[model samples]
Target: MPSATHPSPPDKSRAGPEHDLTAAFPTMDLETPSAIPTSGQCLDHLKLLEAFHVLREDVATTDGLYGIHDRFVDDVYPSKGLDEKEAQLLFRLREKRWAIFVANAERRYTIWFQNLPSDRGRMPGQLALAEMSGYFEKTSGIAFDSGINPPLDILMVWHAHLLNPHDFLEDCIRYDKKLL
Candidate 1:
């Protein structure tokens, strides 16, 4: 992992000409809520935390090139092909989202992240997209296609269905009505 102090940014020269991602996500708050917040949402935050920890560990024990992977993963979001600065920017954005989730517990919220399905045609290559959709489908009281891959594929939504806000609400309503 590379030292955070001298972390390399992705090369601007290698960036794809078709898109200007820096402009696309000018700020983190521009992101929309694709699904409601739940424990899986919190776990995603934990994953980012773990990723960050791994980067720190690499920086401390190795030459810091390993640490650069964290930045690389960040920059490669959505479409890929980003410079180092862009990658760091992406990491910071995700970190901000994680922070918000940690700091605010009372507020009802939603989950939105990078690399989601913008075009229906792009779905096949994206397994995470399918997973998130399943989670939302099952919990949101909406029917997701049964054929779609389940949320288990992405390492989110593991057995904590009760942590899902929709499922939580459904259980509450059912209990209130003496249906459970």
Candidate 2:
């Protein structure tokens, strides 16, 4: 008796923990696909975009501090300066280099995450976080890449903690002030 424009409300009697909506409405076709990305895909895309922006900014800042752009031009073509096209290409190359570096770091982190023990609960992770914090506190004067790398387990926790920037900053300020 329902018209095409106004369908009857779904039966409340059929709605319960054991009720299956698909079985109740076989013709509803709830599995229809769309162009929209899933929430996980959207999150991955957003993270990639943010990482791209951060890499671009880091490259620009490094160039400004070290005169990498001028050095590139001088080393590649001393006699004649780069044209607009060549300048753009140089920028792209630098961006690509930074992207590769970031990609490698992400790959390492992924491997580290995958190798974590399944049986152990949060204790291992908490210990790694503590170790990472201690490393930062003790190595205040040492360069990050000064021939020493933090353990992968510690780095994994540090990386995850860093994703929540506000919490990380607050914890750093409270307990690990030297890390700031």
Best by lDDT: 2
User: For each candidate, C-alpha RMSD in Å?
Assistant: 18.2, 21.1
* Model 2 TM-score on a 0 to 1 scale: 0.35
* Candidate 2 Cα errors over 4 Å, as ranges: 1-48, 64-70, 111-119, 122-127, 134-180
Top candidate on TM-score is 2
Clashes of 2: 0
**Candidate 1 Cα misplacement greater than 4 A, ranges:** 1-90, 94-149, 153-161, 164-180
TM-scores for all predictions? 0.19, 0.35
- Model 2: per-residue Cα lDDT over 18-83, one tens digit each: 633223233333255668876655554454444444444554435433334436645665545456
Candidate 1's TM-score reads: 0.19
The whole-model lDDT of each prediction reads 0.39, 0.45
